[model samples]
Each structure stands twice: as structure tokens, then as C-alpha cells.
Target: MAINIMLATAMQPLGFLSAGWLADWAQPHTSGPGRGAALVLLASGVLLVVWGLAGLRYRPLRHLEDLVPDAAPPPEADADLDAVQNRVLAA
Candidate 1:
């Protein structure tokens, strides 16, 4: 969709900002810039692979309703308080 494309396009600057923050604040002194760069590269590669797989799939893997039942009501609470009151009266 257009919205997804727009958001993906806007992510470039955010990614740059995150990379800069990682380089400045999060990166370790001993491991240095190379390690920081490697992490960023690995993360980007993973994102690309996931995005490609999702894009290639024409239909949803499964519908939301297929995963969860819509009509079944939630379980009711117990009558423990009533039982406690009855026990107190009998005692």
C-alpha cells in the first residue's frame, strides 16, 4: 500500500539517526566502529530478507479469524466469594 511505502521511504533518515546514536553512545570502546558497522549491516540484511519474503507472498499466511475463535465467549469468574459466605454462615 501507499502508506507502507511512504513509511518505508521515511525510515532511511531514522536508520541513519539510529546508526549515529549506536556509533556514539552504544558502541563499545574496545570493539570500536567496525563492530558497530557490522551489527548495523547484519540487522539491515535481516530486515531486507524478511521484507522480501513478505512481499513475495501474495496472500496472508493465515487469516486473523483462523488463528482465533470469534464467537466463543470468555470463561466466567468463579463463585468462590459465595462459597466463602455460605461457609461462614454455617460455622
Candidate 2:
């Protein structure tokens, strides 16, 4: 869970950098700023489509829900509080 949080936090800046790089690359090939924006949108859409198709093609990805079991339900709030209180009293 900690690693997941760290990776998610790290990805935000990387996402911004990639978008900026894509815009720069598109700017050179297109006519104006507006055209560059359009190109970026087109490229992003293409990438999404390709990603979706790949997910569908991959068996494990396509059946992700079946591949992984659901997490156990969390302990009840009162149960957790009681356990903490008992530990404090024991200490």
C-alpha cells in the first residue's frame, strides 16, 4: 500500500513531463498552437485505443477480476477501538 501511494505520487510529475514532451513534438509538425493541441489530443486518443485493445488481447488483463480475489472486509470500528483500549490498559 505504501509503494502504491509512492508510485501514484511519482506518476503525476511524470505525466506532466510526458504531456509537455508530446506537445513539443507535435508543435514542430503542425501549423499553429491550436493545431498542436489538436495533434496532442489525436495522439492521446490513439494511445488510449491501442492500450484498450492490448488489454482486451491479454488474457490476464481481460480477466483481471477473475484473476485476483477480492480483499477481505475491514475490521469493525468498535472491535478495533476495543482492541486498542485493551492494549493500552495492558501496557
Candidate 3:
């Protein structure tokens, strides 16, 4: 749940990131349409570098579960025993 929340928080900033990248790309680098695209491409390359440095620090949300797999199932009878013990102790 915390991982999902963290990802949601990160996603909120990505839109502004993408827009800023687009703006940088669309600006006239050399006063030509092709130059604009090239500038955008260059900006995108920088974005990739920045994202790699930051995002790589944490496994993306989809991959978080893979980082720590669920443990094996506990013994069913043991679980039942634990429940009964709790009830008796509570009483």
C-alpha cells in the first residue's frame, strides 16, 4: 500500500516533467523545425539520464513485489491453534 502511494506521488510530478521537456524541445535551438525536434530529442536524452539516476534508486512500483516475494504459506493447523490460544488467553 505504501509503495502504491509512493508511486502515485511520483506520478503527479511526471506530467510537469514531460511538459517541461516538451517545452524545451519545442523551443528554437537553431531556428528550424528540425532543430526544434532535435532539441526535444536532446532534452529527452537528459530526462532519461535524470530518471535513470533517480528512478533506479528505487525499483519501479510494478517491480517492487518482485523484489520481495511473499513468504510460503504457514501451516493451516498451526494457524488454527494460534487462533484458539488467543481466544482462551483473552477469556
Candidate 4:
């Protein structure tokens, strides 16, 4: 989640740089096609960054079973596991 946030934040600067370059290259035409393109890129970049931050809000919990912290298999299950291990070792 943190990594995603960082990446999305990174896109903002990249989008700005690209838009600046395009606007400069367009010169007088910048107010026409270049400006429109820059606006689109800027908007899209902002959306990406916002989306990444939203991911943090939806991250899953690591431990769902909070009622029992020391939960374990029954003793019978442990004994069966041991028996299986012993048979494998003997073979």
C-alpha cells in the first residue's frame, strides 16, 4: 500500500514535466492542442495519486481471528501428526 502511494505520488511530477515540455514545444499553439493535452495529463495524474491513497483505506486486516490468540490443533490431531512422522521416519 505504501509502495503504491509512493508510485502514484511520483506520477504527479512526471505528468507536470511532460505537460510543461509539450506546452513549450507547441509555442503559440500551446493555448490550443498543447494546453488541452496538459490539462488531461494533469487530471489523469491527480486521479492516479488519489486512487493509490484510497487503496490504503481498503487494505485487509492481517488477523481476522482476534478472539483466540493462542489457538492450536487438538491433542488428537497432534498425536496423529506425530504417528505419521514416526512411520515416515521408520520407512
Q: How well does each candidate superpose onto the true structure, as a TM-score?
A: 0.44, 0.58, 0.36, 0.32
The number of clashing residue pairs in model 3 is 1
Per-model C-alpha lDDT, please? 0.70, 0.83, 0.73, 0.69
Q: How far is candidate 3 from the true structure (C-alpha RMSD, Å)?
A: 8.6
Q: lDDT, candidate 2, residue 5?
A: 98
User: Candidate 1 on 1-91: residue-level lDDT in tens?
Assistant: 5997999899989888888676555357437557766776777799999987886673544354475666754333354777767877999
Off by over 4 Å in 4: 1-33, 61-91
Candidate 2 deviant stretches above 4 angstroms: 1-9, 72-91
Indicate the worst ten consecutive residues by lDDT in candidate 2.
72-81
lDDT of 4 by residue, 34-67 (tens): 5756765676689889976776565453233454
Compose the digit string of candidate 2's lDDT tens values, residues 6-75.
Answer: 9989988987878877778788888866777688888779998998898899998788889799887655
Model 3 misplaced regions, further than 4 Å: 1-27, 58-67, 70-91
Best by TM-score: 2
Ranking by lDDT: 2, 3, 1, 4
Cα-based lDDT at residue 30, candidate 3: 67
Q: Which candidate is the best by lDDT?
A: 2
How many pairs of residues collide in model 4?
A: 0
